[model samples]
Target: MEYCSLIQLKTTMMNNFLTLFIAAFVFISCAKEKDPIIGNPGLAAQGEWSIPLNRILDGGPGKDGIPALDEPIFVSPQEATYLDDDELVIGHSSAQESKAYSHLVMNWHEIANDWFGQEPVAVIYCPLTGTATGWHRKLNNQVTTFGVSGLLYNANVIPYDRNTDSNWSQLTLECVNGELIGTRPEMVNLLETSWSTWKTFFPDTEVLSTETGFDRSYGVYPYGSYRTSEGLIFQVKDSDDRLHPKERVHSIISGDYVKAYRFSNFPETAAGIILDNVEGQNVVVIGSQTQNFIVSFFEKQINDEVLTFSLPSDDLYTNGNFTSSVILTDQFGNNWNAFGYAVTGPNEGDQLTPTMGIMGYWFPWTSFYTTVDIYGEQ
Candidate 1:
């Protein structure tokens, strides 16, 4: 599983370009012209190499070999017997339709391409990095699909778009190879929480069914020991020991600035919220340590008045039917859910704008944002 030697091999290949070219020419001459190359040949010359070419190793699967779920099937929460209550899921809602992509299913396929109303998107989860993100599939007016490139960068997944065969770094959110090098895709907010929390909040939610066309174990994790182990299977260009290599964190990035909040640092037992100014914009993070979940949103504004937030106190709800689940209350006394929707009070139908962020391991987040500021550290 160790791939550190690949870096040395790549260096040797680059140093002896004439020999490599002669070998490639001889092999191509013997092969049929009709045979297609596995990846874009132009990619080798494009984009800044974050790491040496040789370090990007094949992850035991070929292009689209991991199979993204294009036409996914779903079952209601009550009927989703495949999921354990504590299992992780990525929840997305659009036009009143809620869908849950179980870690059980994503652990194998890694990516699911589907439509939320008319908006086409790809739900991507990288087990190695503990990252889940939603990507808008439309690029330059054309709807595209993503598949596992079977490549790894910084020990994280690299997905390639079928429209242009360009390899994209999931952590960097940019195309590193092919014709679309340096391009970035629009990101959508995806709520990462436990299956129980999601089901409790969205009882009518549709859970991804195990009846996907591919034949594989649906509820079982394929990567044994990797999830809990400290060692990495692939090589990365840099490393940081500021935090545990695999410690999970919620990170917010704006331009080149990044701020990370470790789950352990946030009071798990208290009903409180963290408010901070990131990149000059007000941001709030709320979560329950007991429930094992966290969510963040940008502060709301009305009539040019920026609103501040606080957790609801028992005295504020003495006459109302509020519960501990209602974690956020704005200065205007509006109660909001974890997803930032106002369940009651003056802003009943209004929803706070969810900030762009990711829940991932410290290693990959720091590798991409080396100078990231960690909350609570001077």
Candidate 2:
């Protein structure tokens, strides 16, 4: 890997055109009620970092610069007036409950230590890379909350476990520094979709409220034009410019192999399914641009038998009652929801295992996977 001194790295970042512009916007928009940053170099000490140490630069809030919410409050869908139908949100559903966390709230706070009924989860998100993943907060017997380290590697957030101060790369999905280095966090299923789409899937779903302890502009996007523009605030190790840098794609990864499925690649604007293999693991990806969501699941029956899936019918859409939650039906006559929950037929109440995946911008995936394949790319 290319290497440089820490000072030289910071200087190089400051010299970048986007950095200089974004640096000012971040300090003002992202920093907490206190000072701008605290300069926690704990993860940078002792040559302990997995990635190049020089690449770990101070993101203006220092440690806990952008504070992570622990057990944040939630409101009913009717109470969340801040949300609009078209606004995007990170959503997850399980046997017990379904929840939606707005990007309006997430853009300010990158992590949320939340409870899904009896289960504890951390919503790890990076607004810069536009990626969100659900991580199980418990490692072994100890339950730990994750906090923002106020550091950026490849322009993505590096979250540290509060229990051990071990740094984890959100995009890498692995511990890169501290006591737990090289460890991978256990992930849960999550999808990014428009608020209207998710609400339709689970109308009774609770919405993450703005009642977070910190005071900030929960409605405003702190990073201006970052999502739409091709420019990056920090440089990344990217080579393939096959798609626009800011274009979002849903990806499934098994070991080192990664395959991306784009919204544009879907055969129709309504929900559809794609069955393919990644690193020898069979996966089924479902998505819809018009509905505005993307998700994936491992193709297998509860008894460990392989299964294939296809849309149930076209009449569901023609009737204008297409909720998209139950988009596919397996050959075993079992109907599945977008979260892969078997809702009908023989396997009723069973759930198809979700693949190791997340929705993210095109550039960050290419940076880490290096040789990612785009599904249906011509």
Candidate number of the best TM-score: 2
lDDT (10s digit) by residue, model 2, range 1-378: 245687788778778967778887786555423333333456455448888765666787788978899868899999999999999999888778899999999999999998877777899889988999999899867989999988888778999999988889988889998788899988878878899988888888999999998899887889999989977777666546888988999888766668998988775545667888888777888878788777888768556767877777564454433554787787788888878888778989988788888888888877687569999763
Q: TM-scores, in order shown? A: 0.82, 0.86
User: In model 2, which runs have C-alpha deviations exceeding 4 angstroms?
Assistant: 1-47, 302-306, 313-316, 319-321
- As a TM-score, model 1 comes out at 0.82
Tell me, by lDDT, which candidate is best: 2
Residue-by-residue lDDT tens digits, candidate 1, 303-346: 68887787677853333322434667878878877667787888
What is the Cα-based lDDT of residue 95 in candidate 1? 40
| TM-score of model 2 (CA atoms) | 0.86
Error of 2 at 19 (Å): 16
Shift in Å, residue 146, candidate 2: 0.6
